[model samples]
Target: MEKRYASIVFRHLTADRLAIRYPGLRSVPFVLATPMHGRMVITAANALAAAEGVIQGMVVADAKVCLPKLVVMNEPPGLAQRLLRALGLWCIRYTPVVAVDPPDGLLLDISGCAHLWGGERSYLKEIVTRLRGKGYDTRMAIAGTIGTAWAVARFGKASPIIANGTEVEALRPLPPAALRLDPDTADRLIRLGLRSVGSFMDMPPAVLRRRFGGGLPARLRQALGQEAEYIAPLRPAPPYDERLPCLDPIRTAAGIELAIGRLLDTLCARLAGEGKGLRKAVLRCHRVDGKTVQVTINTSRPSASVPHLLRLFQLQLPRIEPALGIELFVLEAPTVEDTAPVQEALWAGNPGLEDTALAELLDRLKSRSGTRAIRRYLPAEHHWPERSIKEATTIAERPATAWTTDKPRPARLLATPEPVEVTAPIPDYPPMLFRYKGEVHLIAKADGPERIEREWWMESGEHRDYYCVEDQHGKRYWLFRSGHYREGEPQHWFLHGFFA
Candidate 1:
């Protein structure tokens, strides 16, 4: 597709901003000045002030002589760039690719976006009208390339929209400064009788480079579309993303749901075609009141199912507060993974981790309750009880080692063991009674004191002698004693887990 760009030049950015903040200053002649070399010098002049003999870089005292009533206000450092940045962000409603051209300009990549607003004429008209309504004096132009657009917006007096293949014609009438050359290079070109771009545009590259250095020739190529020029957007577009712009504000839940459904359908179709699925997706809502609210959903497995993902997002709809109304909806899938096609079974059977229904159910449950509400563990290749299990990374991940069923294991295992006081008849005997959490339980039936040694390579730690004890109430507990009894040191007992 052919690329198109738009440029906006603020005629009186600094003076216009001051007038915006103080409406009383709109009809008055004023100039924004700053301290320079120990003397206050004019940095910007409004239209009224410029009509007089007042101009930028003139001393405040000198400007006052031209217009005695001229209002001179202090120009804060970097204020113009700051205002341009904020204005660029607000322009995102028009195009997603908005870049701030420093000092007093903005560039927008409106390649295919203009058609949405009816046409390039209507699109540019809407933006310029809106900015002018907000008290900013702006000149806008659109062209097939950024260089030509920028040059025409600032210098050309013809039409705002430049046709494709006419970049050289459009740039020929403009001055050499329109190519964004440094002040010194532009002055050199002017002194050498190259007043307009057309004068030296067709000159030999080697001659231009030898006379004026490489900057002039490089910028010339860019403006003529011979070389590519790219802009650094304020917000980079995400890889897997979809956008929906509403004609009117969407205040009702049904409107939000409709927007989300449309976005998901388009996004899932793209993902399915690429044999990829999204694991995490975010829905960002741009509101009319200049606020953004978002909802995020994550799946246990990569999924391209629109219905399943839509249901998951529906559970989080209440969390979004549509104050005033939402104007734009953006859906982004930041995490995506390649998915393999699964064969459908003719008859109903156990699908286990491969069950799409189960995965969808888990995703819904997590969205409703919380991410930490559910977890899956797999057997690990280790002898230590603490190291015997590991959390599964993916839903379909398989364990490398099989679970040992020869010994009795607890249904609920504690992450860390807690100390407990116990009374035993002998050093190797089971606990007759134990006190845990200040509750004394008398042991009714007790099993053997099974010894499990700690893995020395991992760390040097005392081995545990585990025991399965049943209290008076038939509640079973797993208890362990650290190391063998010594002559002076006391034995430490801990309650490790419990059985159902």
Candidate 2:
């Protein structure tokens, strides 16, 4: 695709901001001054002040002299860049690639974005109109290159949207300063009777470099599309993303669902073709009021199934509020995984953990409850009960080692064991009865004084002598005694786990 870029110049960024905050300043002449070289100098002058012969860079005392009634306010440090960054972030709904052009400008990579708003004319108008509504005086231009767009937005007066391949013609009439040259270089060019870019358009690179330094030639080449100029966007664009522009703003839940279905269909098709599936997907709804509403969905396993993923998103649709209406929908898969091919089933029945249906069910359960609510555990290569199993990263993940069934482990194990009061006849024998949570449980049947030593490499800790004991009411309990039992010392007993 042919690349296109846009530049927005805030002619009176600070002054306009001040006017917006203090509405009365809009009607009066004012200037924002900051201390420079031990003296207060005018950093910005409102349009009214400019009309009265007061301008930026003029000494505050001189500016006051130009208009005795001029209101002077101290300029907040870094206000210009701060304001530009905020405005650039707001412009993200227009294009994902928005770069802050410091002081008073922003750059947008609107190559394929303009078509969403009808065309370049409508796109530029929509942006300019919105900014104007917010009380900013902005001038914007779109061209085939960033250099050309920036030059035209600041200097050219003909038209805002420069046609592709006509960058040379559009830039020729603009002044040499439009090429973003240093003031000294521009002044030297003007002194040499080269007032416009056209005057030096045909000059050799070596000659221009010798006279004006290398910056001028590079800028010239960039403007003419000879050199690549990439914008450092405020946020990096996602690799797997799809955009759906609605000609009419979407308002109803049905409309939103339909949009999600369409987006999923498109995204899933691409993923399926590439043998990949999205693990996490986010849907961003850009409202007409310049606000964004988003809903995110995650999968238990990588999935390319449109209906299943759509169903997962359906659970999150109530979170989206289409305040005025949604102008665009962007589906971004920030995390995707390669999906392995699965064999067709000979008969219709559950395929256990490897089943896609089972994965979908888990995804739905997680979407309704939470990511943490659903978990899968696999046996780890460890002897300690706490370290025997590890949480599976994915539902399809295989265990490195087989589960040890030689030992009869409890169905449920507490993360940390609770202390229990036990009465045992001897150190090697199981407890006769245990008081747990202030309740006495008489041991009806008992087995084991299984000794589990702590893994020395992990940490230094006392070995546990575990016992599987049953209460009088037939409830089973797993109890453990800490350390070697001493003749005089009190033994530490803990109610570790329960078995079903």
The TM-scores of all predictions, comma-separated, are: 0.84, 0.89
C-alpha RMSD (angstroms) for model 2: 2.9
- Write down the lDDT that model 2 would get: 0.92
Report the lDDT tens digits of candidate 2 across residue range 215-272.
9999999999999988899978998998888989999999999999999999999999
Error of model 1, residue 266, in angstroms: 3.6
Clashing pairs in 2: none
Show where candidate 1 strays beyond 4 Å.
Answer: 11-86, 238-240, 270-276, 334-339, 342-350, 425-428, 451-463, 472-474
Error of 1 at 339 (Å): 4.1
The regions of model 2 sitting more than 4 angstroms off are: 33-42, 58-62, 72-79, 92-96, 112-119, 191-193, 273-275, 341-350, 426-429, 442-445, 471-475
Q: Give each model's clash number.
A: 0, 0
